[model samples]
Target: MLETGATGPSAIVLNGGSSSGKSSLALALQSELPGSWLRLGIDDFIDALPPRLVGAGGFEVEADGAVTIGPAFTALEQQWQAGVGAMARHGAHLIIEDNFVSGVAAQKRWRKALEGVTTAWIGVRCTPVVAAEREARRGDRIAGMAARQALIVHEGIEYDFTVDTTNADPTTLARSIAHRLAR
Candidate 1:
């Protein structure tokens, strides 16, 4: 069998909901892990999208905190994921944080994109109530978004391990994850 790269995981995919400390975890993981990992996430991808697709004829952040995406947004998202996976394939270390609203189907898509690339899956968990509170406190996020995604994002998708962001801070969580995965 052909050997994979010797530098450990090419990518670490962190799945979680809004306000779930995923971004925070990614930042800490960069410090904890032994690599210059490039962080590409759902929000970063969305922010880079064209304004037209951000709301009209694209993805919308609803008043109730629910998110809706159209075909255009999905198309771009697929391309974006593939691009990130390609980067990993070419030897870039990646930290990806995506909310898998479509559950296993979303994971399958990522698997297809990441073919032949070593990857680690992490489920970043937080209680809906706690996420909701964080979302409200952040003020930059839409209301109820945390509650809408907290549990839904984890459905039908399994991870190599899970981390609870309900109480543990990002640095602590990343340290724990790094130590566990390092073993």
Candidate 2:
């Protein structure tokens, strides 16, 4: 839902379940666009958090033992806003990769955070089997398959474009996003 007057190269945000090629596609888009675009990953913020601050499984567990992602998501939104601002200032496009599907409330919070930004959310659609296999291969603290499945459901409702990446190459997916931005 971005308008033409957005004043940037149509920012792309890849939001999807774990192991759904969000990171890969974002990185590919960054490479393809080169100096004209910037890629930001939520993992970069999550992974850099102090170890003790992040609890079991490390998917933004809050101090209340609840699997809350508000803090991390706030950080991501702040970063995304900054990136958009920077890109607009420098006349470049922006791409952000994130698993923003914590819950309905979480999505609402993110929507509020993005009110002023010119952004589009793209979901990388993949089967549960493929998602699990990719998550296992990636070998990160993704909680578990059930958690990933839950995330997929949440993300499915929050995307503008759902690209099935089970058989597509990362670069091709990136091109599709780029084409959207270009249009």
Candidate 3:
């Protein structure tokens, strides 16, 4: 559990495989957690980024079909870290939802960025079959699921809490997170 003092809200990272409900989970955390929690989605950061940095061609598509973020990851990370710092100064909890693929490197980065705050990672798991179905229903782009899954396979193991979102609704999941945060 994160310490709830004058410093800030507990910080959490929501990440997972395709269709694992990461975005929805983060949105819920913003409301479920006490006080006001700021959310930083890597997608939003990337989408709003200057076109110059994104470049014409992006990262190579892995065999798993995941679209790896190119140099944009660096920009997003910098912005996210800055946001976390600012939020901490204001005493706000931060919940970041993004597909930060890779390994131990990311864990270290998270630790450094969220220093002095309660921190945890929530990983959602869903089979590829389930992923595809949800993608269709969620109106995801043609390649979004595969890209998300590839990133998860590369990064999910680093998380502290792994949940299977295949059966849980957003409210149920939010309640579950709230229960945990309360502890």
Per-prediction TM-score: 0.93, 0.72, 0.77
Order candidates by TM-score, high to low: 1, 3, 2
| Predicted candidate 3 versus true structure: per-residue lDDT over 1-183, tens digit per residue | 345444334677776655667778778767777778778776676677667655444434454445555656565766677767567656676777755565556656666777776676777666667677777787744555544673455452565556776777777788887776565
Error of 3 at 111 (Å): 2.1
Clashes of each: 0, 0, 1
Which has the greatest TM-score?
1
Candidate 3 regions with alpha-carbon error over 4 angstroms: 1-9, 55-64, 147-156
Clashing pairs in 2: none
Write down the TM-score for model 2.
Answer: 0.72
Task: Mark the 10 consecutive residues where model 3 has the least summed lDDT.
Answer: 55-64
Q: Which lDDT tens digits does candidate 1 get at residues 1-183?
A: 112255568888999999998999999999999869898899898889998888967989899988888889888888988999899989899999999876887898898888888888899999999999999899999898999999999988878889999999899999998786665
What value does the lDDT take at residue 149 in candidate 1? Answer: 95
Pairs clashing within candidate 1: none
**1 against 2, candidate with superior TM-score:** 1
Among the numbered candidates, top lDDT falls to 1
Candidate 2 per-residue C-alpha lDDT over 1-183 given as tens digits, one digit per residue, 9 for 90 to 100: 555453434467666666778778877887776366667666676666667546544345433223454465456556655655555445556676666555455456445545555667677677767777776776754546423543444533556667887889999877776676656
Which of 1 and 3 is the better model by lDDT?
Answer: 1
